[model samples]
Target chain A: MSERPPVPVITPGALARRRLHVMFALDCSGSMRGDRIASLNYAMRSALPELLSVAEDNPEVQVMVQVMRFDTVARWHIDEPTPIEEMEWIDLDAGGETAMGSALAQIGEALDSAEAGPRQLPPVIVLASDGYPTDDIDAGLEQFFSSAAATAATRIAIAIGSNTDLDTLERFMNSPEARLKPLRANNAPDLVKSIKWATTAPVKATSSPTNAPDVASQLALNAEQLEAPSSEVVW
Target chain B: MSWRAGGATAIGASHIRNKRPNQDAFYASPTQQSDPRFMICVADGHGSDAYYRSDIGARLAVEAFIEAISWNLDSPEQINSLPQDIVQIWRRLVKQDIGRNPLPPGFERAPGRASDRDIFEPYGSTLVGVAASEQICIVVQIGDGDLLLGYEDGTINRPLAADTGLHGEQTYSLCLDDAPQRVKYKAIKRTETWPDFVLTSTDGVSKAFVDDAAFVDVVRHYRELVRSGEDLQATINALPDWLRQVSDNGSGDDATLCLASRRYKIQDQ
Candidate 1:
């Protein structure tokens, strides 16, 4: 009888996987208190599974998530880029002013390769806000875009509720060439769908083996298709 | 002079949920026996919904690569232009496949379908391969993956560096509009005593390692196995199981490995 081939010993380095950082900057202002904040929390928690699915499909690319909440002050709810499967979402309560500028500044700082891991995919940044900024939006955006990593990041903005400042959100998108408009969510269902789309679509699209067109261009196309009258959710 | 070649691919653990076919594909020409000339190609399909037919695309890519090299074997100019030739043939095959198998009902068209250029989006995949003759070997790659040459002196090195990008998963694919420009090509001349073996694999294997050095060590380990003379058939047969463990514990993505080795006879034997 032939002897069986020896079982190959697995090495420690054999388990290493590449990472994709995904950051969420949420507006937890006074205006977002009650149902709005509740919906945001629910939407984010629900989006976790879909995000994990993306990570599973693209095993070479591990999805690491970071979340920042901004009210009168901006701070990281989850500071480090934690693997999506291992990450736990803590519900954020709403109060205070919309210091979105400060949040953007913080996001910019985190975008630094030194701060984030040097070896990671271009990050996916999703900003969901229900109100305008109470601070210098330009100053924050400038600081954020200064980092080449941040500039290359796929940026998506969600205008939650009717009071959102679309102009500011549009500028945050930073893709004038793609002409992608900010996603709008008028109700709980709309907010959930928009959040789901914002979180998963870019990760899925950008992770393709092909030279995926810019996320902004892809989003613009999605927006057009979703905006059609027959579509379920109007973005 | 003859060669021993074998290639295999395993589905990622993550794909089991949907029962999605293995998105990675590989082909080794002259499968029947050792040949002085042979070609080996491996392709990884884009795992996005937009790339619905990427599995087929990957298979077509390897087939096209083999066909291109086979047709241009005797022509130095055509061999040098393998990158361009492969893409041309690949695009033609993709179009033909699309014509034969129309999109399934209610398939979502990729965004920005204004022209024929967008039509190839569904069949997006990355190609990395090599064609070798008795005297020369050519390596060509369009996207992410590793191609390494193992020398008889126990040194192993990647012929073409893995394309690094801010996004780890993003890579140049054959479906890209600028694929012709993005494809990387390298030609290696075989010496009397060097590069005893060649291995081509998708990112799944390398990404499983902590770093490039660690990956090189794994390749070296394989090189030792091939050189161990413990029965080539056994080594080849055990590769898929070994790769399955690599993916299960590491990247959990589809993994593929194609190997080619130069055989030397022992005068005493």
Candidate 2:
């Protein structure tokens, strides 16, 4: 009988990888008709490459993206969770009243186990809004947070411009223990930076093999860094 | 005493971007003609930036486990203390490694968290192992992984209980504060009919299966294949490619499997 090799033959198939679901909730209210909407579109479109890079690195973590837009009513700009590499950003126009509440409710329903497939990793939900919700914000948040998946989701809210409702955004961020504060972007540049950071950083951090803070806390830390320079800016 | 053993470790397809080393490590002690004992250990490093050195940590864990077992072979009471003893040895090794290799800049705290002290966090990894002699088989696990015993009757049984509330992609690790308490231990006394094979693997391997039953089928299939073959070395050589296929078609993660089997005698006509 031939002697067995000293080293075990290592193979590639034993690890069972998982998928990560990332959803974007955008506000397409009339207040965001000009630069705000344009910046949001540009940020979303440009951030794709980075997101795809994350997906590529974490091959085990298949990234699926879903886009939801809310104005007079909430609707799916991209209803299905498409692989990050294949996802294309459809530019959204802003012209109707903000329906943040409806959007949240819709997302909450989708997060339900009955509607969503087997829960993979905790889903990442990013919200970008420029105004107060015109609909029933309380009911919407109640419905959204009711689902365990939604409650456990890594939620981040981006408040565009000073006029945006911080209270609504804060309420939307339900993970108090996570210590995540809403990101406030006062201009187009800040908006772009916040969107890119909010979208990509958490994904990259979570995908890492070490212990990582939940997505909410990660975003909060990034928001603090983004705001640091502004506080130091000398006019 | 007759035993045939082979094992392997490879990088996951998804971790290419970070150029992350394969965080999974395995060790199969060379079969000694006199010892009549077989041992194998497999570990998976936690996949978070905080655990930057988890690849090395995993290697340390398996090595430490094997060493701990060898030193306590005569004492069954020491075997009960194996979990704590192994962790202590692993921590000592990690501390020594850290002394030689300082943490890179900005790794003192976990990324994005100001208060978290992540100095030792990078060495976190999950460990699962099996040590078997002619009369007894022992299984120990800390965190997520699969360990099974295949009987001559073509049945595979998992020696460890399922981890509950460990939802999607989350697993306990040796670096966690409560790791010592979380260690699971099982010992099976060998009967007149010895188990056909003993297999231990990290989560990557088990995640590829559709369900637990399917996992058992794969174990049974491997046992049957090994039992049918005369050239044990050739069969071991062929395992890597088959495992790669399983990973490519299933989870696309780094997959590893280690097998220790008892040699079967062929009947003469």
Taking the tens digit of each residue's C-alpha lDDT, what string does model 1 give over A1-235?
4363532456665566556789999999999998889989999999999899887777667788999999999999999889898977799999999999999989888878433432345788999998899999999989988877677778889888778899898888877564777887877888888888889988876553333433355557776654422235432
Give, for candidate 2 chain A, the lowest lDDT window spanning 10 residues.
A209-218
lDDT of 2 by residue, B213-255 (tens): 5666777777766676544455556767766655665555567
What is the DockQ of the complex in model 1?
0.33
Model 1 stretches astray by more than 4 angstroms: A1-8, A17-21, A33-35, A41-64, A80-96, A111-123, A146-154, A175-180, A196-235, B29-33, B103-114, B161-168, B190-194, B264-269
- Cα lDDT for residue B156, candidate 1: 86
Q: TM-score of chain B, per candidate?
A: 0.91, 0.89
Sort candidate 1 into its docking category. Answer: acceptable
* lDDT per residue (tens digit) for residues A153-181 in model 2: 77788888778888888888865663787
